[model samples]
Target: VLRDERCTNLSSLIFATIFFGNLAFRAYYSRKM
Candidate 1:
């Protein structure tokens, strides 16, 4: 149970990081173009 909880938290953190990273990239790309 504890291991599952830890995995869930880690996955969410990674997902949030990727989501924000994608948004930032899009903003930068649009500004450059």
Candidate 2:
């Protein structure tokens, strides 16, 4: 349980980063179109 807390937070942060990054990339591509 001790390590799980840290892993969960890190995993969520990574997921959030990727999600936002993809949204941003899509916006950029849309603007170019």
**Model 2, residue 6: C-alpha shift (Å):** 0.7
Which portions of model 2 show Cα errors greater than 4 Å?
none
Q: Where does candidate 1 stray beyond 4 Å?
A: none
Which candidate ranks first by lDDT, i.e. highest?
Answer: 1
Q: Write the per-residue lDDT of candidate 1 for residues 1-33, one digit (tens) a residue.
A: 999999999999999999999999999999999
For residue 7, model 1's alpha carbon misses the true position, in angstroms, by 0.2
Candidate 2 lDDT tens digits, 1-33: 979999999999999999999999999999999
Highest TM-score, which number?
1
Model 1: weakest 10-residue lDDT segment is 4-13
RMSD of 2: 0.8
Q: Candidate 2: lDDT over CA atoms?
A: 0.99
RMSD of each: 0.6, 0.8
